[model samples]
Target: MILGLSKHPSDESIVEGILAGGRKEHEALVALYKKFHVSLERFIIHRSTGRDYAKQPEDIIWEAIEAFVVNVKKGSFTLKDATLETYLKSICKNLWFRYISQEASREERQNKYMAEWDKLEDDVSDMLIEKENWENYINLVNKLGKNCKQILDMRLIEGLSMQEISQKLIANGTFENDQTVRNAKSKCLKKIMELITSNHQ
Candidate 1:
């Protein structure tokens, strides 16, 4: 059933297939998956804590390939922006983020999904432990002063651009100017980084 996960093949051929953006493009994408899946899976397996995620690395690879093909088709990206390796790696990273986000969302939506799915308890425990450890660190940050927390929160959590945050804070009268907020932000972040780096659970 699997086709490509065995070799890198010719990069030019793969790139050409991707640039084609049609049925052949899909097939070449599939071929690229078959070529890279095993190696990628092995790479993730070494790092993924023996979870089922390691079992589905190819799915992530395919998602990345599909998204990349769509981007190429839609003119969202050009071949000039990247080589095959850079493009594929960026796709893989984005796919991993999406996969993780979806997985987390699903778990939150169906807390008992695992209980019904027939997985080992120890594996579930491992997931829970990692989740709890991360939450604890977040809780530590929650203990920060409100302004310090808000600065980090806007920039890091809300994913706001620094310029945007500067404008927003000035509008709200949080500081006299944008540079003031930026300076305050740098100090708070450095302090929090030091705190968490030294005291992370």
Candidate 2:
């Protein structure tokens, strides 16, 4: 009936077709879209009624389908107690929630960065009386210890969050946690202030 295939292919057959690849994979994907697209679209629209999604409902459904196909091919999707429909819906929900969380987190970080930058400028301006003194301040920042310099550069120059900096440091076994990065960044700022004050004295 659909794509010259049976009216309803069993879930096992669909999985097999997808794993087999080539024309079978293409047919399987088409069949899946035909079977579940409307229901999934309704579900997504219902769940995301008031939300501001960057992607449209159709786009999300397609993305979910692609993710499902990829997961099946990768052996990540094991239809145990749940049906294929259930699994696909779960993926769609998770993707949407993750997108929302990331957008919220990005906004939060931008706001925090702006506030911190404003305070930093105010503090530095008060300390550095002349243009040359500002140059001295930059030199002082560079003269900080390796960890301090890297953390400041990541935070100030690269605009990375403390959590992001922590992850990078943890990968290389430099620092343990975000709290540690926070402590180090604070110390770096204090050290700069001390150096600036001493220069004036």
Please write out the lDDT profile of model 1 over residues 1-201, one tens digit for every residue.
212423555655666677766665776777777666676656544545455653277676667677877777687877679865567777776667677678778778665643432233233334435556546546655777777777766765676877898888889898889768866776665566556556645
Collision pairs in model 2:
none
TM-score against native, each model = 0.41, 0.51
- Across 14-44, the per-residue lDDT of candidate 2 in tens digits comes to 7888898998888888888878888888888
lDDT: which candidate is best? 2
- Our tally of clashes for model 2 stands at 0
- CA displacement after TM-score superposition, residue 119 of candidate 1 (Å): 24
Query: Candidate 1, TM-score vs. the true structure?
Result: 0.41
Q: Candidate 1, 138: how far from true, in Å?
A: 48
How many backbone clashes can be found in candidate 1? 4
